[model samples]
Every structure is written in C-alpha cells, then in structure tokens.
Target: MTDLHAPAHPGASGTPVPAVPEQPGTAGTPGTPARDAVPAEKTGEPKRNRRRVRIDHLRHVVVEVREHAGYRTVVRHAAYTAGGARLLTRRAWDSRTTARHERMMRAAEAAGNEELVRQWEQRAYAYRFARHRRRVELLQMAINAPKAIGYATATGVGTLLILGFLITLGTGDTSDLLTPIEAVVDFVGWVSFLASVIWEPALYSLPLIALGAAWTVGRRQHTAPAWALPADAEDRDVVPDEGAIIKALSNLGIAPLNKAIKDGWQPRWVSPTTRSGPGWHTQLQLPMGVTVEMVNGKKKVLAHNLLRKPVEVWPTEPPKLPGTLDLWVADQGSLSGPTPPWPLLTEGTVDYFKGVPVAVSQRGEPIMGKLMAANWMVGGIMGSGKSSLVIALLLGAILDPLVDVEAYVMAYNVDYDPLKPRLRALVKGDEDEQIEAAVHALRRLRDEVTERGKLLEELGGDNTKLTRELAQKDPRMRPKVVVFDECHELFMHKEHGKEAAELAVKVMKKARKTGITLVWVTVSPTADSIPRDVTRNTSHRVAFAVGDHVANDGLLGSGKHKAGVTATTLIPGEDVGTAVTVGFTNKPFEVIRSHYVAREAEKGVDEVTPVVKRALKAYKVGDVWEVPETAAADVLTDVAAVLGDEPRMLTQEVLHRLAERNPSAYLEWGPTDLKAALEPYGAEQYKSGGKSMVSRTRIQEAILDRLAEADEDEGDPEI
Candidate 1:
C-alpha cells in the first residue's frame, strides 16, 4: 500500500524523495507541487554581509576616537571659548540695561516678598532716570565743548608767556621770550610721534586680548560638558554657581523638572549662594509642576551632576519661604570626616529643661535634644553604632544628678558598666530572668507615670504639666529616664512579648507629661520587633544605618522614606555614629554625627570615667530618686524612716528593725554595714552612753543640709 503520510524513501540515485499530499485545487491542474518545485542548488548556502560588518567596525573606531584624551581636550577648549563669549555678552547686557534688576524683582515676587519687589522697582526706576540724565548731559557737553576748550587754551598760553617775559627781564636776554614757545612745539611733536608708533599695534591685538579674556572666564567657571572635561577635573568639586545648580536640577531624572527646563523655565534665586559654615547655602523657588520632593528623591543623581558626594548635598524645605527649596552643598569630604569632640568632655553640666547637645549637624550646628517630656525610638542594625548614640544620650541625662537613669541591656554587653554606680538600675544579660526583669521595669514605670500624674494634679493652679521646679520640690516626681537596649529581644520573647509591648505602649503614651522618658533601642526594625504603637507615640526618632525602606520607615515614621529623609542611605560601618533624626532638633529633621564616648577598656576613661565619678560624687545619699518597685531599698532613706522620732537607738537594734522592714534588701546588714552606708552622708554611728548608737538628730540634720545644698546648687529651677 502507498501511504501519502509516510516518511521519505531513498531513490535509486541515493537522493531521498519527500512524499506530497494531494490538494483540492491543484491535484488535477498543477504539473508539480509547490514544495517540490524549489531548486536544490540554492539550499543551505552561507551569505557574507560585508556592508554591516564595515558599518559596525566604523562605529567602534569612532567611539574609540571620541574617548581619547586629545579629542576631549580639543572639545573642552572649544566649549571654553563659546561659554566665555556667552558669559561676557550676558554681563555686558546686564550692565547696559535693567535686566539684573528685573530678574531680582521676579525672584522676590516668586518668594512672596513684596518688600523686596518694591525695593527693586524703586532701584530700577532710579537707574533709568540716571541713564537718561547722563545722555542729556553728554549732548549738552558736546554742544558747548568747542567754545570752552578755545578759552582754556588761550588762558594757559598767556600765563606761560607772562612767565617767560618775566624771566627775560631778569636775565636781559630777549630771545628767552621765544624759549617757552619752542619747548611747547617740541613736546607736541614728541607726543605725535609716540601715538603714531603705538596706535597700529594696539589696534591689531585688541580682538585677540578680548578672546583670551573670554576663554579665561569660561575655564574658571568650568562651563564645558562633563564628558569633555579633563580626567582629573571631571569629578572635581565645583563652586555651586548658578550654572552648576541649573545643570544639576535639569539632569535630576525628574520628568517635570526636565520638561520645565527644556521649555525655557529659569530658577528664581530667592537667596544667592553664600558660604555657610563648611558649605554653601542657597534658596531656590522651583518652577510650576516641579516640587522639592522630586528634587530630594534624586539627591544622589543631582549631587553627581554638581560634582559632589550624595551626603554633601542637602535640600530642605525653607520655613520662611514657602514653596521654595533650601539647598546646602557641603565642602568636599567635610561631612565624611570625624565630628568634633563632645562639648562635655572638657567641662560642662546639663540642665534637662534647657536640653542637651547630643550631636552636631552636617553644617556644624549643635543639635539640642530635650530629654524631659520626650520619648525616643532608636533603631539600627548591629554594629551601626546605635549603642554609641544611646550612650551619648545617657551621659547627657545622667550628668544632671537630679535625674534618675536606668538601663536594661538584653545582651551581655559591658559598654555601660563604668557608669553602674551612677545608674539606679543597670541590668545586662540574655537570660530569661533578665528579659523578665525588663518587663517588670516597664510595669513599674507605668505605675510611676500614674503616680506622677496624680502628684502634678494635686499641685493645682495651672501646674497641669510637670516642670523643673516641681521635679525639684517633690521627691518622687524627679525626671526619670528608662532605656531598653536591644529591645527587640524583649519584644519578640516567646513568653512575655505581648504583655511587654502593651506596657511599653501605655508608658510611652502617658510618660511625656509626667517627667519620664522611655527610650527603646532595637536592632531589628520590623513591625514584629518594634511595634507600631511604640513608634507612633515616640515622636522623637533616631535611625542609624538600616536594611531597607520598610525598616527605615519603621524606625523613622511612615512616609519619611518617600519624603527623601531616609537613614537607609547611610552606609553601615563608615557612617556608624551618623544618624538621621526627626523631632529632636529645631528643624523638622537633621542628619547628625553623634558624639562618641568610648569605654574604659578602649582608653576612653579620660572622657567618660571622669564624668561618671563626678555624677556619683554629686549623688545625695538620702535624697529620694526614682527606683523600681522590685529594686532594693535605699539604706540611708530606710534608716531615717526606721528612726521615726526616736532620740537615739543602738546600731544592732537598728539593723534588726531594718531587717524586719525589708528582709531581702537589708536582712544581712550589720553595724559595720550601717556605718559604711552613713559614712558617705557624714552621719556615722558614734559611742553614746555605753554602746555604739546612731543619732537621730545627726541623720535629720544631714538630710536637711543635703536638701539645702541641692537648692543652692540648682538655684531657681528652670521652668
């Protein structure tokens, strides 16, 4: 059987014949099938396309030549001449008319400053009037010039002749009269010869000199394209002039900005670029359909266009000039270097109400952070120097002896061990018990907040909020700061995470007005690690280098990343101590390099240890400060309470009574322990009657003296 769908079969001549299917229209009329009509000679032959090969080779050669140094240098020189000529023409036009004044008026109008607009208008009118007056005076002088010159010439000749005549009379030489006229003729001849000799050469060189001047100006301003500039000068820092700013804004990859620039829109300079600290500051009024946020989002691209590092370019929204961008471009490498030493290292004391200097802005301005009535959320990755920032804040708060400081580090890190004596509560461990302790600390802080609120209410008379005076007046109402370091461990704990987070949120919500500051330091910035409730209530946020935009917004507030205020831009190790903080400084936000205080083991004792010792020495033994409910009782305060109006008591008997009061705290206390505790207060036990006894009068007097000294040192507390 012959099958039409069968595979091809070999023929007698060793060529395979393909089977063809019968078609409805072509079966009876066609001589051969269309598929079998193709010629065998033209099958599978390679073709050479020489034209495309030659075109591609030519393109490669052209690219190579364009990238050569000589080619770039020639292009740069050509651009220099053109740019210089344009600059000179613009300068001449401005000087000859009121274009400069008109531009300033427009800038003032855009900035919404009516006063500046009026001032510029008056100046422009004065310029026009003065120009017309000068033209009229020139015409008048031309009309009267011939008569005045003739008269002046005749007067000068007559005076010279009279002098000559007098000399002739004295010397009796009649020819001397003609001597003055002959000398004048010779001077005129000499002047004519000199002018003839110099005039032609000066005329021939004038145009060349003008061209050279233009070239010099162009090169100085770096008006060439970036690709055409020399290799060494391509990325060099520019002066941040008007042209540079325009170029940066135009190339920011922003659609509206680029479109506006292409359509002949010009920037309105509300303030000219001026040197400010280690940078240049300027205010710009953007065109329609373009926003400061758009510019901010392209900060890295804009910085590269302006020949600067991304960190060096800062664009902010100006407070006074609404709808304008406040731009600050730092000097090359200024912000990347180390910040200045801490101010307190040499000599200083902090008053909590006045705020403390925690860090310095990139502009070298101090960042004053309010510790009282403020809660902070500090977030960063490990080794991002978040701990260093925490230490700086703690150092500032603890320096004020009246403020109570406590820290609970979830990890076994000893960075804060040197200040343990000054810290009311210093707990450091990764154990379950330590995490439980931190949870208990938060519970106690919540209770203290409630107590302080009631105390403030009792004061009455518009003292609705706690003030420095109130904190000084009441023993239990002093300013207290509680820090939970590596708080993610506590928040993510299997047993107590939910309860801990709830208590933290409650404390943060009510602590602001109660003179208690709650600082949560977390390594992970995920929603699970740091709850949204904590971040939302803690208005002041400090974020070091983080992982991504999600973490960035979690550490900072939502929409901060999109607003171009992000810590994710910060490099981890290089920008260890640097952070972007909001609601902490006078401005809405700032990028600051926090002051560092190293540990004693790292040879930083000279800076930190001295401050801690001073704080310890300044501590009042019996004065009431903040302490957790589970904390051990104060030895001095307990002794005073145990005395209870007794004239005197034996030391052994007092210890027995203290043991009854708080067995876990003072159960093992002996006469020696009692003496040791009272020694610092200057109210040690003394021999009375027959046995060693504690004096009630001495202890009471000591407490009164301590209170008096506090009042004297602090004077009137700042409100």
Candidate 2:
C-alpha cells in the first residue's frame, strides 16, 4: 500500500504518483498518515541554472593604467563600460519548490493549487510596484521643491535689476549732473536720523530691503511644514514592527519592496511591518483586490494588505506619524505581589518613565523622545488608586534623570499627617494658612508668568519654542510639576479664591514653555466654585467614576457629558484601578487596570490627627465676616410666601392698564401684585408677564427707612 501523497520516500524521485485530497470526508484526517504525504511528482530536485550577475572587470574600470618601462600611463577606457559594469538582475524566477508545486498541480488540477499560485504571483507583483512608486514620489518632490529652480529664479531677477541699475548709472548720471553733492549728504544725514528716530529721507534702504525680502523668500518659505498626517481620517494607524512584516512576506513566498516595484506589482500593505506615525498618508496606489473598483470600465490594480487599529489623530500643520506610542496599558502587574523587572513586566509597552520606543521605516534612528511636561492633573475617588498613582508618578520621576523632573505636592486636607514620611513636610497650617500657601505659590507663579510674557513679547514666538530655548540654556533647571490633592479646600476657602483663580489663569496662559504643568484633584465642584475658563482650557483631562453629570461636564465636554454618561457609571470588568485618559486632542481612552508603585512607607498616625484638628480649628475659628447659614427654602419661601400671594402698590403695569383692563377703584392689587402672586408659576406657567412682589420682611424694612428720612410739616398741621 504505497501512499501517493507521500513523495516517494525522499531519495526515490522521478516516479510519478497519484494525488490525494485532504478534505474532511476524504483522506485529510490527521490520524490518516497517507493523507499528509507529499506526492512523488514533487520529490525531484530542480537543477540550478545560473546567470551572470557579477560586475565585469573591463566595464567597471572607467580609467586604465599599464606599467611599462618603469613608467605608468593612465588613460580613459574606450567604450561600452556602463552596460557590463552593473549586473543588476531585472527579473526573478521560480525556485525548486515552485517547480514541485507546479508538478503536483499539473497532476491533480486542484483549485487549491491554482489559488496558491495566484496569491504568490499577486504578492510578487505588488512588491515590484512599491519601489517604483516611491521613486516617482521622490522625483515629484524634487520637481516641486528644487533648490536649483529657486536659485535660478532669484539669480535671474537680481542680475537683471543690478544690470539695469548699472546701465542707468552709466547712461543717466542723475546724481552729479542734476543735483548738488550737498543735497545727497543732507539726505544721507536725515536718513541716518530717521533710522535712529523719525527722519526717513534716506533712499539707500530700498535696495537693502529688497535684498532682505529676497533672502527671506529664498530661506524661510523653504522650511518643511511642521506636521503631515494621514488624510481622510480622524485617527492614526499603528503598524507592527518591521521584523514581523519581513518574516511574514518571506514565508508567504512574496518578493519585498524592491522586487515588487521593479516588476510593477502592488504588495499587500500587511502588518508586522514597521509603521510610520500619523503624518504619512499612503499616496502610492496598491492593488486593493476587488474592494476598490473604478466606476469607469477600466483596468484596476489590486493587492492584499493588513491594517491595524487606528488611534485618535492629533492636530498639526503637516502631521507626522509617530514612531512609537504610549498606550495606558492594562493587565499590568499587581502592586500587592512581587513585581517583575520593567522589561519583563512591560515587554511591549514603552517604559513608564522613559516613554521610548523604536521608530518605524528608519533603521537606527535617533530618538530624543517626548517628555511629559512636568504638569498634569490627576483625580479619582478615595479607593480609585489616587494615592497609588501619585506614588507611581513619584517613582517614575526618580527614574528619569534626563528630564530632571522635580515634584512639589501641596495637600490641604486636614488629615495630611499620613504624608509626613513621603511628602517633604510643610507646616501644619490652619485653613487660612493652607489657603495662603496656595496663594503664595500662585504669587511666585505670577512673577514667573510676567517674566514669560515679557520673554514671549521680546522673542516673538509661542511658549513651546520658548521652552525648548530655556531647556537648552539650563540643564539643571528641570521641569516642575505641581500636585494638588483635595484642592477643593483651596477654592472652598474664600480668601484664596481671587489669588488662586488669577494664578490658575496666569500659569495656564504662560506656563507651556516654562515646563510647568498643573495637576489638581477635588472631590466635588460647583458652578461658582470651580473656574469655568480653567476647565474649558485644560487640554488633557481624566475623569474617573465621578458623582454626577456636572462633574462629567467639567472634565469631558458639556454635550457628551450630559448625553449618555452618568456619575455612577461603573465599568463592569474593573474592581479598582479603572479610569479614562484623554489628551489635549480629547480622545477618550478607557483603562481597565493600571500598575502603580507599592507603598514603601506611610505617614505617622498621631501627627495626622493633630494636623486635621489644627486645620479644622483654624477653619472654624469665629470670625465677624462669616455668613450665617439659612436654609435654602427659607431664602426662597417662608417669610417670602406673603409676597408670592400679595397685591402690589406703585406698580408700573397696574396704573394705565388697570383703567381699561380692570376698571376698578378698589384696585389694591395692581399688575405688580398680580405678577407677584404668579411667582410660584414658571415662565410658561404664567399667562402674562409682570414684576414679582417683594418679600413682606424686606418691604417693612424699606418702609421704616423711608419714614425715618421723611420730612413732616408738623407746624402747619391741619391749620
């Protein structure tokens, strides 16, 4: 029972054998040994056929020298050197494996065989076209932004003008013949005065200005656009590493970019290939299979490629695709247990502190990488890993020496005694003192902000550029990150409001280049309590499971917040360490879990209680300016209930309108009283509009004041 599927037991070849189908009902079962055998026809080895692809010695030499009679003479080679010197193979051929497959197909005539062949051919074709298309792009760029073209144009115009001026000087001689030399000297002196202050008679500045314009045109406009991103998309594509793509293509029997392009084929843009960041839009047309067809009845190119998930596209003039990305990765190691080494723990992710990764398309590229601007806002409820995240951030700061990041934490909570060991201690200040510290920090920030404004004014550029300049000048002057936990106290305390709010605006406006970022967390916020402009201007936001939609609106935008989201929205999979991250671009990314540093230390217990007591006492200390609490309903109703039901006097609406509308002498109730009575009704609840009545308590007070001020005619009473 010789198996036909098996290829003649290795050495036994050239013997023809029958084909076997591996379908489920047929002979293809794994238990069936014959089903997995290679056919005898595919067993034969193919003889190698070589073609010369080496550099020809005679063709390679442009110049030749011969030593004769103790002297050597060099002379150019005669002709036909270029053709033979280069042995670039133009076309590729099938290997022995292909021949074996062909033989098997010829014997069996299977559909599977045909499909495999077609896929191979298509892959080869796509690769051939990619290189040529890239070259086409390069040529287009050269034509579009050629230095020679600009240089030629500038030279031609400058030469023509200079020649015309010289000719005019030789032919006209307008200076000496027409005007006196004293006039030119006076004009020059006046122009110099103008250059200094107000005089502008100097004619020499014209040529200089022209030269400056040409110089600016020749250089400034030539700089490349800052950003270039993908088109027809609101997001970015994340491609696999280049090594993977190369291996996959090799396994699939497809030629790579060079071969595919030369053969005028489109290779499938498959994954496992290196990905360039956002700005790169693929202009080279690839065979997209039958998916993208032309409306017109014409031939269309198609290829097979794989695409990865897209990321939210950040804005830039000409967007640049990122070489690497920082994904807030989930399923990280648990902080409760022993932690693994960074590389082993975060094998695929960028280092938490370093944030570095390999760039796509470029081999051995230098990556300085993006640094986190020392400022960021972090917030979460008590058990939502807020403390852990802070600890992790601190540890990360300690790890990264390049940025030289420093941290300053300000806790206004009464029970900050727990932070004594970790946080460099600040005084156990009263509520007012805590607020004062917040304000004092802001005041220091004020001077810094003023300095930055002046710098921007003087330098005439944005804060980002200014930051780069400052960083370059001072290495030790590292970025500073300001952290505020339970910062609501700062705003809740009335005294710190004006200074804090003003400081927030100032730092936000000018802090970009200064490497100062603000990170504040509050448990609750109200409309009047939190600054509106600050919330709106903050580009990066993270709102964990908050209490309500209003807080949602504060973190996310107003529309999205109120629409579908609620404060108690629970992500089912996460028990803890769950959050949502958003960047300046406002792309919300969900986080199921996060890794944080273990608590190496804790603040002492007794100290925290005293601090809390001190803070509470200072806050509760009796003050004259303190407002007495009145129930909300009391302010709205109670004493005011009489006004809601009463009639009004001296009412603007009642006098003339009452004459026709009501026609009554006993009109104790005017339109004013009528309107007042309708106070309980809403805008739509009422049939008409009128002034609301004043509360009786307020009315009585007003009456007493007026009576005291009134002048009575007591002497002429009733005479």
Candidate 3:
C-alpha cells in the first residue's frame, strides 16, 4: 500500500510540498520514514516486479558528502518536532578540513582560478545559510516564549505610565490623566455618554480639560510672583559635565590617562562648581601611576578637546591629595570684566610696614605686598601691562610718608611725569646721560644699604632688621623704594652694563634688611637681560603674558611652569595687566589683574594722582624735596669752571676739576661720563696733542645755543 501521510520536503522552486497520509505498519512513525530507507531512483530501463512502497516516520537523518581527496567532506542533518522540521546541523567533517580547503581556495584565488573560486564560494554560502537558518529558528522560539512576552508587556506599560506622569507634571496640567478623582467623575458624568455616542473620550472631555487647564494657569500665576522667575528663562547655563571632560581628556592622547583607562582604571569626578566670575572649576581623582603633571602637560590639547578656552590645570593642595588635578575652564576666550580702578589711599592711616593694595586677584580679593622689606621683579612681553603694574606699585609706595620714591624711566614715558616733584631722584630718557644717572643712583643705593645696615645693627633692640620703631626713631632710615622701569635698558647698556647689573644684584640681595626695595621692571626676562643673581634673590616676582614657557619660568621661579603656574597661557594684548604673582604671603601663586591708572588727558590728571597728592601733602611733609630744575645750566656752569683760564683742556683735566667743584655728583665721572653729560648740549670732544680734549669755546657756544633755544621756546605763545 502506498502511504500518503508523509511529511514533504522542499521542491526545486524552494516551496514546501503538501503532506501525504501514512499507511499503517509500513514505517517507523506516522509521518517520518525509516532511518535506513532510501528513495527509489528513476531509470530509463524496464523494471521487473517493482513495488510502489511509501516510506514514513523519519525522526532524524544525517547525510555525508565526500570529495575524491578523502579530506574534504560535509555532514548535514535534519530533525522534526511538533513545531516543524528544521535543519539541525551542517558542518565540515573535521575542523582541519575547512582550513585545508581554505588554503587550497587561497592558492586557486591567487592563481586567478575564478571557476574554482566560485565553486568553493557557493559551497561556503550553502553551509552558512543552513547554520543561519538554524540560529534564526532558535531566536524566534526564544522571542515568542511566554516569559519574554510577559516581561516586555510589563516594561512597555510601566514606561508609558512614567512618561505620561512626567509630561503632565512638567506641563503643570491638572488633566484627567494625572487627577484620579477628576478622571473618575468625568468617566461617570454625561461626558461618558457623549464619549459613547461619539466613540472618542478625548473629544467628549474637551470642555472639562479646558476648565482644568485654566484653573491650573491661574493658580500658578497667583502662587508664583513674576519677579521670582529667572530674568532670562531661556538662557542655558552650560556647566561642564564630568563624563564629557574625561572623554575629552581621553581623546587628547595623553599617555597617563590613556594607559590608566586601558588598564581598567577609572577616575572619580567631583561635582563641578561655578568660579567667582568667568570660569568653571572641577576636580578629578586620577588613577594610580598617573599624576597631575602628566595631565597639566597637555592643557592646551585638553582645552581644545573640551571646546573651552584656555584651561588652567594645577595639582590639588591643602588637602593635598596625590594624583589629583583641579581644572578651571574659562567661559570664553578671554577673562571677563575690565580692570578695576586704583583704590584711594586717603581714608586710612598710611602704614609702610604693612603693604598697600596694588592689584586684585581673580577672586576679586585685594593683592597687597610688603614693598618696604622686599625686592620686586616685574617681567613680561611688551604691551603686557608691565608698566601699569609698576605704576600701581609705585603709587602705593609713594602714598606712604615713610617711603622715599625714586624712578628711572628709561623709556621716557610721560606716565611718571606727575611724580617728579615727590621723587628723590627722577631719571628719564634712554640716552647715555640717563643711563649714567641710573647707574649712579644704583651705586648710591648700594652705599646706602651698607650705611643703613650699620645703623640697624647699632639700633638693635630685639632684632637687627629695620623695624617701624627703629625707622620712627631715626628719620634717615625711612624705607627707600627705587623703581627701574624698562630696566633692561640699563642692564644691556654698552658702557654701564656690567656695573649696573652688579649694583642691582647687590641691592636685591642685601638691601631688603636695610629697608630698601628695588622694583625692577623689564620686558625681557632672559638670563642675558636680567641675571639669575638678581632674579633669584628678589623676594617678589610678577610675570605678565610672555612668549613661551621658558620666559614664564624665568620670570616666575624655575620649575613653576612644570608645577602648573604659568603666565604663557595669557593672551598678549587682550590679557593686559593680568599676571601671576609668586612669593606673596597669602597665596603661593595667584593670578592678579593690577589696578588700572588711566593716562592723563590734556591737564586732567589720573584718578590716582589727586589721592596721591593729598596723601603726600598730609603725611609726606618735609620729606619730599624738589630736584634742581636747571640741571643743564648747572652742568654748563661746572664745565666753564673746569676749563678756567684755558682755551681748551684735556678731558681728564676737566673731569678732575669738575670732581673738585661737585665732588658728590662727579666723584665717579670718567671721560665717557663727562661726554655723556655734555652730549645733549652739543659740546664737542676733539683730538689734540694725541689726547681727547674738550674745547672751552665749543662749551660756551653750546651754552649759548641752549639759551637761544630757551628764548625761542619762551617767545612762542601757549597754544
């Protein structure tokens, strides 16, 4: 009997055939065939006594196909269950079989065996397709299982409820979705009848919804005042996220951070906070073997990655945790706000013992330094507010009665012109005579340091250092502060360079005990311009925007840049008056913006001039001395006296005679010094008798020329 209940296999068109009914007692089961059974082959020959037997009830079958090489073989199997029949496995005979076949395939491919490559590719595709089909069947079973269905349904419902509640709360709506009582009442009212008729609950509840919304709006307005709301509600406060910052630091390719992260280490991020004004502050606990220096070295790259402008990176202190870095990111490219005005010194009693306010820190706290017993070095690139910082310090010093101010402005800037009357010595211009005068003043200060040291030693009570009590007892021991603006000019001078540098180094090292403060301001902070002897001994250092880290470290102490206090990050012109101050008492390193003193407009004086003048008048009585206004006339008269009764004299003879006339001023005068003094007056030095000699007639003519120019200047009317 032919069985008709056999399970169908796929036909040539890739479609399943209809199942046939099975015969009783002819196969292993109802729908499967016997495991050893094989299908009859169709032949073109006559058959003898052929029985049309139908096989059935096959539970599983494995078929193996082998190539002639005996090494390449494939095994395929199929299994059937109540769900349906599926391919159970399709695999190589052995693991090495595929590898060997791949090697042959590569050889064929390299030899351009397109036909062989295609045959192998088709075989590989068939095997992968069978495996993928099995995987998909298993995935489908898992997805459609009862547990998965129940879990997914619960998750979806919970998510929807949460979203609805959040939306209702955020919108401040008292709608049916959020209010249970209102929802029940609406459900039971005539609106329910309308909803049943219209087949839309939302449409029927429109009137109730409108009233609830109106009530919510009115209640909110009544409870919350307009003034309580933020002025700019739409403004975004874009605080930096810690996760984003770590990602940025990782992207910077820093070795320490990358290696730590690669080694499965994670940094602990602290909550970010707003800085006082222009920036944000955050901290990170770095992984072991990583350091703050490692992070600080890549500050610029980190700033680039974080999309912020100029980050300040430093190690954490106070609590002083190792491997901790504190990062400050500016809100914009430049620090916000204008420079604060110079504070008036008139309200309180002036105390030279304690410092005065010269600048403001980034936190807006006043930055004061003791100018009485400390030497100061101010260095920066040009136009970086070195002059302004120096002026602020000078204004602070001059306001005190105990401070005797002297300034040598080698640049001849008119900013210090108003201070001339109060200055013990004022030397201006970059000429040779001005340089000589600066050298002379430095030498005089060096001698005074010795004299004051002796005085302090003699007046020693508990301390040999000059105290306010000692200064009060002896008026001559008043604190002397000398400012050398553009001091590089004096240090780099051809003739007086060596002597000037030596004298400056001496004053900076030994003068602090004697109550003499030397404020040296220079644009160039290189070793050649300002020696290490002077830079290292100076008690206070302020650095403005410089060219590079080398200059920054030079101005601030060595290793300061590596330790993460750097001024090189400051912009040149935009960050004017902003500097890093070191050696201050309150803070080891602080960023300060010096008080700005505006330039005089016509006769209008600076904002600080009036206050300084008043302070000087009240406290600086009998201390201020007027410098001789006729320096040129006095020099010419001295020259005439030196060349008495002779048509001309040797330069040496003139110097000797001038030294005799004004020994205090000309005691150290040389030929070069004499020439520098008289050069502005057009005095001529000529060679006579193989010796350098000055002509008396030329000196007289020079004096007459100066008188004539003075007459011409007086003849012109004031514009």
TM-score of each: 0.63, 0.33, 0.52
Candidate scoring better on lDDT of 1 and 3: 1
How are the candidates ranked when ordered by TM-score, highest leading?
Answer: 1, 3, 2
Candidates' lDDT values, in order? 0.77, 0.37, 0.66
Best candidate according to TM-score: 1
Candidate 2 has what TM-score?
Answer: 0.33
Question: Candidate 1 on 170-264: residue-level lDDT in tens?
Answer: 99999888788778889999999999999999999999898899899898777775556766653333788777787678667887776565455
lDDT of 2 by residue, 320-430 (tens): 212111111111122122222221112121122233211111111111112343244445556654554444343333232223222233453333334333332244343
* Candidate 2 wrong stretches, greater than 4 Å: 1-375, 398-430, 453-464, 467-469, 472-477, 525-529, 562-568, 571-574, 584-592, 601-719
Which has the better lDDT: candidate 1, or candidate 2? Answer: 1
Tens-digit lDDT string for candidate 3 (629-693): 22332777888887987998888778766654543356456766777888888895776644679
Name the lDDT value of residue 614 in candidate 1.
69
* Model 3: residues with Cα > 4 Å off, grouped in runs: 1-237, 268-279, 311-322, 330-334, 345-349, 601-605, 619-719
Off by more than 4 A, model 1: 1-189, 196-237, 248-273, 282-299, 315-327, 603-605, 624-719
What would the C-alpha RMSD of candidate 1 be, to one decimal place?
Answer: 22.0
